[model samples]
Target: MSKRKEKTSHGFLNNMNFMFREQWNFEKTAFLFALVFILFDLTVSFIVIWLPKVVLDSINQSISPAAFITTIGTITIGLMFLKYWSHYSEQGVLKSAVNILNMHFYIKKDWKILDMDYSLSSSAQGKIKIERGHNATSRNIYVNMASFYPNSAYLLKAIIGFISFSAIILVLNPIIILILIISYLASAYVSFLVQRMEHSFKDVRAEIDSKLYYLLEEINHHAFAKDIRAYNMKSWINDTTHLFMDEKYRLENHIQTKHFMQGLFDVFLFMIRNGGGYVFLIWQMLTSDMTIGDFIFYFGAITGFSEWLKQIVMRFKNLTNANFSVDDYRYLMDTKDASKRTKGATLPAYDQPAELVLENVCFSYEESDRVFINQLNLKVYAGEKLAIVGANGAGKTTLIKLICGLLHPVSGRILLNGTDSKEFNRDDYYSLIAAVFQNVSLLPMSIAENITFCKESEFDTERLLDVIQKAELSENINELKDGYHTNLLPSITGNGVNLSGGEIQKLMLARALYKDAPLLILDEPTAALDPIAEDLMYRRYDKLTKNKTSLFISHRLSSTRFCDRIIFLEDGQICETGSHDELMALGGKYKEVFDIQSHYYKENSGVKLR
Candidate 1:
């Protein structure tokens, strides 16, 4: 597992690098834009510093009022317009760059998600889908810290700006330069501490997110929500949720308080920097070494550097937060999926025909002792209909899933025509099997598309018509406004209509028929239909399955009468196997179940079931 983790981590980086490489050219463009923006911003600072000196010198001299007024006015208007254009260009180009980055993140991340395993897919949805989305919208807050920027360039620009400010300060006095340097170092240290606190808060948020997901999944899937409410579990839900929320709230507050304290330190440091520089300048002026122009330049330069330092500190905080997101993204990307074999034994591909053989099959999920199937043995001949009858928890659906290659048995071999099923490529093996379960999911598409499973080109029009009639869906289709072409979901805009449960079941049957695979497994296939439709289904199933091997499961005894043979499963073990009449004559579990069902119908409806 450790080795697997390492391998996945390496692969994840390679995948991320490949995705980022596509934007390398755009990154260069952004770099160029950054340089332009920085130069323009620095130029404005220089103007602020030097222009005050020019004006102060003019004021000190005995100059013509008209000339001085005209010169200063012309200079002010031109500088203001230049500043406006440069700032606009900087913002426009940077915004475009950010948009491109967003596009790259979304498109590539979506691709990676689809290719990932089920666990990682769920993880990505939780983290990248939510947190990453929030972060993307907050790009202005974190872009500097996100590792998206060229950090070396940022450092170089800051150094250059600092040098320019220091040079001006040195001209006044070197003491001001020392003050600015001290304040910057102090702010950097405090910002680092605040970032560590923020990271701890983010970890707490992740735990909250996990608990919320569990609550949602349970509410949506299991009978938990209904049972809970029925048993008055509102207090339990409230307590659990509040406990989760309170911890998250407390952590956030702690982090926020730390951040505010860090900001306070920044405020105090700036005051000391500016206050000390001004006090030294006053002393120098009183001693007659400093002029008014020098004082103005020093004040302007110091103010600009202080603002720049604040921005740098904020950017560092942003970087720290983004790093946490990066860590999460990488962890999700590094998770291993379901194991697959490359050079293992191969399953026999059907040519003339195929047979299924389960030899001492045993299976379980993870490390659970509650095994679903244990030492189960069975055989299915080519083109034969086998009915598997069992009570709810007897692993009937599990058996069919194993046969369809959806799962692998832990302790036995499943063979497709004498070859171990695991030897075949899982996807290729599944392509030859068709299944319909009690629980059916329909795609948001037209009725015809759902029937054909969107494989229009491959659908046989004649066979499609025949299957629709067999499944008793012809009447339902004919009643639709557009017949089979009518959309099955109205919420999808111009292509939609609602479908009844029976209509949906008929469509599911049509899909299985359209596939026309060698093996068909139907698990409680008619459970959702009315008695009349179910009776019609059983009557036609024998004719429909003429040349295919099928495994049918049903709680309704009437549905199994058409099958060639019946296998009665009880508590993960096969208790009986024979034809319908033979099993009844034997008077086993099958006969007992059939008699109970038959007696009920006879008494309730005044008509014999068989």
Candidate 2:
């Protein structure tokens, strides 16, 4: 757990300025409406406070009934207009503008996550920042950017009202104003303590919330449904959920207790201010020459003054809380993009195959100190078919990611066509290679869109058919009711069809082929296929890699026999390099693993060793 940095007033202002500038027109319109509403509200409050005094004065002076009625009626109409204007501006325009502004921030946060450095964005710390940023903009309604405009407007109104009411009370006696200020200051202190307590619980609440969310997702996810039912895990899950729920309840109760204590203290302070002030006023009215109208006016001023003072403290506290949320949002937005997506050297054309070289490349994940790919050096010639054969933890996937520019090396360079790959823009460099990893991910869209990885309008019909045939997915796709136009993932659409594991892998292969890049990488491409289907796919490998540089990774040693060269990885280094016959002749680690696999196959099917 990292300690959060203390945010300075200057940092808060900077973040606020950034947020306002991002949606200047919308924010400006909201602020204008807020200002109009606040002004009208204050006007109405003051008129209501003053009206009683005027009515009493009219009665004592014995004014004409018609004149009194006309005056009161005019004032009443003015108050109604002000109140209506205030309500209309606040509910109709300001609220809608704020809602739109909230949506803008949500979109901006998601876009930042999409555009940031892939290495960082996929890491543990990156996920924490993403969650915190999301919560800042959406979770807490009172302390989010959307509430900033109205809260600030109310703060301004409080300050103005405090000044106006204070002056009116001061005319009666400065001592009463001083006492009211002292009582409110004490109340403000309690509020500060409450705010601090709430802030302290934030991280804890976030952790519990994350756990609860994971559990709920597990309960609802289709993948977990079978296991949960087969394993009779319902009672266990219910108990776990209740444990966390009880913890959350205790936390809420503790927080509410603190709030209740604060409320009690406020009531005490309210009594001292109002009760003491009223006694002083009554004494002055009885002993001094204060009129009935004066008594009514001064009493209203004292109560209004105290209310305004309380608002001043409350609004300031709310603003302080909102500032913390802005800090979280700003922290994520300011993270440096290590991939340099915006500005970098242009990549060379991919008209022919690309040559790749790794020089003393070293890599490790942030959470681990042990190097996963240590000081590795290797090269793949242009237009060569190379095979990477290794065990499960041999760093094959890590090396492929480094070569594809998904992960950068710690202390070396990957040269693309003799130019350092880092010199090219990350997005531009991606255009040179088409890769299919062990995991096959399919989006909820038409099969054609998934293969093309583009919108329907941008798909190349002729090229799509070519790749589908080459990848051997034409038959499977044609069996579907809508053919290539059929949607995937029934969870997203009623007509969507879920493809089998092998069919999904074939679809992924078609997607990679449609890219038509200079370099192609297949990582266990036939993992889900039957043995015969896998052999058939491997036979087509030559046709697939015919004019491009290709790298094939697999644990099945026999499947890689046709490659021009094979490399065996052990302990994060290239332990052996040779063709299939050459490695077999060596009778080293490669031959040993191959013979074991051959023996198993011979026992199972009585097949001759290759």
Candidate 3:
């Protein structure tokens, strides 16, 4: 148990060092200013403690009234100036430093999430860590380095004050000093118990908070507004929210009860310490040659001693809580990303079309035993348009992710040109391909910036317009008041336009086109469009993908006829592969699905099936 405690102490110190070093690295001047302010503040506090004793003693010494008045006035003015100076430092300098430190951690957390491996970031455990880390930084001010530093400084002050007061009281009566220490120690133990109880609830509280936050966010989210009203889910949502709230309330009430008990214990200790010290001092004054000023000074010292002991206990509790937060944050930041590459061979130049080969690649999700992609062997020739067709769970999208290096294969090699895909730097390898997934995400930026994924200065305006036109989004852009410069996602910005689903898909296509990567992968890219728009997109596919290798994934089998080759997937393996006519001639599963889909169109319209 001692060894465990020692290890925990060691870890806490290391975490504190890490936080201090990072804060210093973020803003050196702010760090130094904070330290200097702490020292100055501590000096002022010590002076305040000693001033009363000095003034009372001088009064007993029969000092001249005018001289005493002058002395008091000078001290008052000096203290007033120090007070305002301290306040200014707190409001102006310290506040800005705290904000900067918070911003640094916020940015660092976001960077870690963005830079994490896709596999880890997408997992349940990783998401929990992310949420916990966010709570660690945001839930309490004491968790912040700026606040923690000041707490440490105040703790030091408390220790110094306690020792100074003990010395003064001990000079008169050693027994009184001993009684105060024992009582205060008892009070501190109660505070420790309360703190431990609160800490134990941290995880449960975080979970409840997370649920409440999600429910609130979803209720207010524009995306969920329609379904919520249409399904009449207001009462359901309210009830769910209240349930979590009740749980949180119960937990808090329990914690507050413990605090209340601790407060009662503190009051009991306070009476014992103060009452005994007063009785002892009274006895000393009556029996010994203690002056009136000495009595007043010793009484004040005893009261100050009690306050110092309380401060020490409270500060220790706060720092311990802060240490726990630091541990949570460090856990997230220290997580190893399996996909990260420190150094690797650069990707081949993108001047020519890229060839991709998957040699018996296999993969499974971390939480599942069953493989999602099993022995998936395939090759795409340079400049070939390959189509992957499958039902919802047939590993079509997983295969695309594996090829894109978003996911790593469990057992086989994925080669780019002739080199293993893992051999190339991940970011450099990513630059070779542009993909459009079913889920469309648009940043709160001007339409042109979204397309080019660059700033206004870096944008190729002509190329942006060309891709927009090619994606058939020219009409939508022209209709908007700001044309291509209009901001998207009104939820994020005051003046932003929300596009229709079809329009957003077109925008995504334009983005992919603007990238002009050697390889393009479109997964259900035209899912949101009407049949006519989908047909129009397919007709222009060859023109858009000129001189580039492209992979098209769609459940609409008829739309893939334009591809050089079509591979039908079933149960994590390829079931059929050929051109449309060749697959139809073979009468495989592809032909069967194509015939069924064509039958629906044939029945709906008088025209013959294509």
Best by lDDT: 2
List TM-scores for all candidates, in order: 0.75, 0.90, 0.90
In order, candidate lDDTs are 0.69, 0.82, 0.80
lDDT of 2 by residue, 307-335 (tens): 89889888877776776667767777778
Task: Indicate the residue-level lDDT of 185 in model 1.
Answer: 83
Q: Write the per-residue lDDT of candidate 3 for residues 16-68, one digit (tens) a residue.
A: 78767776677666555555555566556656766776688788898999988
Stretches of candidate 2 off by over 4 Å are: 1-3, 6-10, 25-27, 92-97, 193-197, 200-208, 232-261, 479-481, 538-542, 599-610
For each candidate, how many residue pairs have backbone atoms clashing (under 3 Å)? 2, 0, 0
Q: Model 2 Cα displacement at 415 (Å)?
A: 1.5
lDDT of 3: 0.80
lDDT of 1 by residue, 405-515 (tens): 766687899888788887766566766787888888767766767877755676667888888888788988888778777776566546677777767777777888777
Better of 1 and 2 by lDDT: 2
Is 1 or 2 the stronger prediction by TM-score?
2
Q: Which portions of model 3 show Cα errors greater than 4 Å? A: 1-10, 31-36, 47-49, 54-62, 90-93, 143-146, 183-205, 246-261, 603-610
Residue pairs that clash (backbone atoms under 3 angstroms), model 2: none
